[model samples]
Target: MKLATQAIRHVDLFAGIGGLRRAFDAVGSHCTFSSEWDGFSQQTYEANFRDNRKVDGRDLRDVQAGEIDDHDILLAGFPCQPFSIAGVSKKNSLGRDHGFADLTQGTLFFDVVRILKRWRPAGFLLENVKNLKSHDGGRTFEVIRRTLEEDLGYELHYRVINALHYLPQNRERIVIVGFKEPTSFSWDRLVLPPIGQTKMSSILHPEDGSEDPEGEYTLGPRAEVNSKYTLSDKLWNYLQGYAEKHRAAGNGFGYGLVGPDDTCRTLSARYYKDGSEILVKQDGRRNPRRLTPRECARLMGYDDTFRIPVSDTQAYKQFGNSVAVPVFEEVARIMLPEIERIKKSKPQTLQAVA
Candidate 1:
């Protein structure tokens, strides 16, 4: 099948190992600029994208906006620690000024606005936690909308899409797309096949299956677990104790018992800290284990080709902090016609010379 030809050019910010970049790239888009803070991510981005100049080079906060030119779209999976439910809950205790005014809003969002005002790219795609809507009684989102819409003159469309639609994981995120002009883009017709019938078992390699996968999502050794590492009777009781407390307080989080026959909940970078959320069943044993980094990549719709270049820790962090590739690809398919309409309506014009 022939691919979409009216390619969209883009820049990626907070480009963790190019997850947003991969999404846009899959849709036939070209990425011209990328900014990432972590050294491992920088190395992985360069290895995958082969763009040494921007991938490992400049810091987003220090780079001058004028130098970044000729990109039609800007993509950012901006830091969520400032806006996530878990992050916002522990804000005041960090011994720092907090909230939108002191901590979250004005800092990174301002950097994006500075680029928007200076470069004025044709469109932008930004991702954040779904809780960003409710944080500070919705003021944080209001600030972002005001900055992007009224101040920058962009028509914005946003929706919370779950990764289970295209993958075996239950990851959910809010994706906001904006255009420089009053856009006629209609997302109502956008339809993506739900992978509801797909379970974690489908992604795993069968004992005799030909596919040679790196690892299975089974219980592995943990320093704390020691020789008693298996989720034995005592461990099950501990999980029950934790669950009971949260159940009493009406909390839905803390510990989750995911079944191999079903999908998993959201995977976070903290999954590495302690495999609390989506632990897998051990092979030949009954104990629950944390999904390996490779499994996390699979749930996030990344293949072995997309991995094999980053370390386990970096891979987990990048996938955990990424936009689902197929999700963005579907949006791009929906928006392609609109992009063509844009070009037909107003062809490129040469700036007036002094």
Candidate 2:
């Protein structure tokens, strides 16, 4: 969608493997700056986007807002594990702090606030887990809303969008869109494809001579998936036993197995452990398998052209932590017109003091 006549410059924060960068880039925006802390994710981000300037690898808490470059839009899929449901549950079970109480990741959002207050970009897009809205009995979301709307005075709009509308994964994330000045911006402008239209088959390795084999993810002349992806008998038996135990207690804990035509559960950073959440069903007596890193990429709505320059373990975590590309592509598409309007209405000049 051609929404802008001139290129919009955006900064990517907490940029995990450049998923949000890919979305903004796809819509003709330029990424002037990016910051991601993890070295592995930084490696993958660098490998994928040759045009991106050096990604700041430093902790954002140590970086001042004045050091960042001016940009028209700010994009951040800031660390969400601190506010996610699974993360909260795990932290509670461990008697650890979560949400705003978690000192490390929970405070990163304030850094985002620091930049927003300094740059006052025409628009900004923030993404996080859907559970963020309900965290701390809505008090967490209240603080965020007040910070962005009442304190900063940005026109804010947010919605919890399911990636199933654009991909085969049942991932849901809350996207927050804001503009510096009031303009016509509505969620109705988003063009979402029908849910369940895309299936696992669309992203799965066909293993029918349709594609060439990659280094180790697929093998042989037929380009079948390598046997390494299949779960071992020991692990499979253990997962089954674990699920049965949970079931006996009427707990909801279990593995999710799905075939080609079905939509799968959310892929999580912990998938590297056992791939229990979303297992690929196998034929005959073979055990189910985890999705290859390439499939995980496609499952998150990334095209085959995207590079995976890290180990499979890192790849799983990166993709799991990434935003669904198509969802944000549509978001970017709808936000561009308003961003351009606001840019034209109020030209940005560097503040005398920030």
Candidate 3:
């Protein structure tokens, strides 16, 4: 797909392994700045992209808005831990606040707001978990909407897009797109591919002689899935017992078993602890295996060329925390023309800044 002919400079914030960066790169945008603090993730990001200048390995909170480079578009997935359903539940169980109530991570959105207010980029794209809309009984989303539309005067549009329509995983995330001035920005333009078109087979390792070997992930010249990926007998039995207990308690906690034809559940950061959410079905034994880090990369819509410079644990977390690339790629495709249009000519109907 052809991207905008004109160059669009964008900064990557909370840039986990550069998933968003790859999406914008799919179109013809230049990443002028990037911020990611995690050492492992930064390692992977740096390994994948050679042009890693302006890549800050510090807390974005410490950086002032004036410190950021001027760009036509701002792209941020922002930390979703404070607003995500799992995050909220985990915090609530621990008797802690969530959403905008949590001071540390929750208020990071304000930083995005801070930068938006300073540079006033022609357009921006923000992504988060699907639960962000209903977090804090809709108050969280309300504040976000008001901040962009009322306070900063940006034309905002958002929607919860499912990755099943474009990938083998059933991940859903809310993408918020905003234009500095009024323009034709519509969600209808992002035409999603048919659901179930892609299956586990697309991303899963065949374990046969079909793929190339990638160090320990795949074995020998045949490149079969490494035996290490298969769960041990003790852990497999424990997970089954735990699932049975939860089932008896009328709780929905269990390992997701999927074959080559089925779709997998959302990959999470905790996948490193236990690959319960998404376990590949195996024959002969009742046990299933965790997806290899390379497979996780493909599951996140990253191409084979993308390097996994980190450990398996960190790779799982990074890809789990990443946005589905194709989904965002299509979103970028639709947003590019609008971004280009807005950049070319200033809009007359600028919303009054509050």
Compare the candidates by TM-score and give the number of the best one: 2
Q: Score every model by TM-score.
A: 0.86, 0.98, 0.96
| Model 1 lDDT per residue over 1-354, tens place | 124576557788888878777877777778878888788888777877866465736567787777664677788877777778777667757765544655443377778888878767667888888887777888889988998999888899988888788877787788888887667787786786865766887654343434443433332332122223235567666776888898899987566666668777788877665566776666566667556666677777777676446755667777777777778778766665565566556677312111
Cα lDDT tens digits for candidate 3, 1-354: 659788788899999899998999989988989999888898999999898383698898999777777688899999999998899999999999988889989999999998888788889999999999998889899999999999989999999999999888989999999997788778888788898789999998887778888889998767878889899999899899999999999999999988999998999999999899999988776678999999999999998999998889889999999999999899999999988898779634322222
Off by over 4 Å in 3: 52-54, 346-354
Off by over 4 Å in 1: 1-3, 52-57, 93-99, 102-106, 213-241, 244-250, 349-354
* True-structure RMSD for candidate 3: 2.6
**What lDDT score belongs to each candidate, Candidate 1 first?**
0.71, 0.90, 0.89
Q: How far is 349's C-alpha from truth in model 1 (Å)? A: 6.4
lDDT (Cα, 0-100) at 349 in candidate 2: 60
What's the TM for model 1? 0.86
By TM-score, rank the candidates, best first.
2, 3, 1
On TM-score, the stronger of 1 and 3 is 3
Error of 2 at 10 (Å): 0.2
lDDT of 1: 0.71
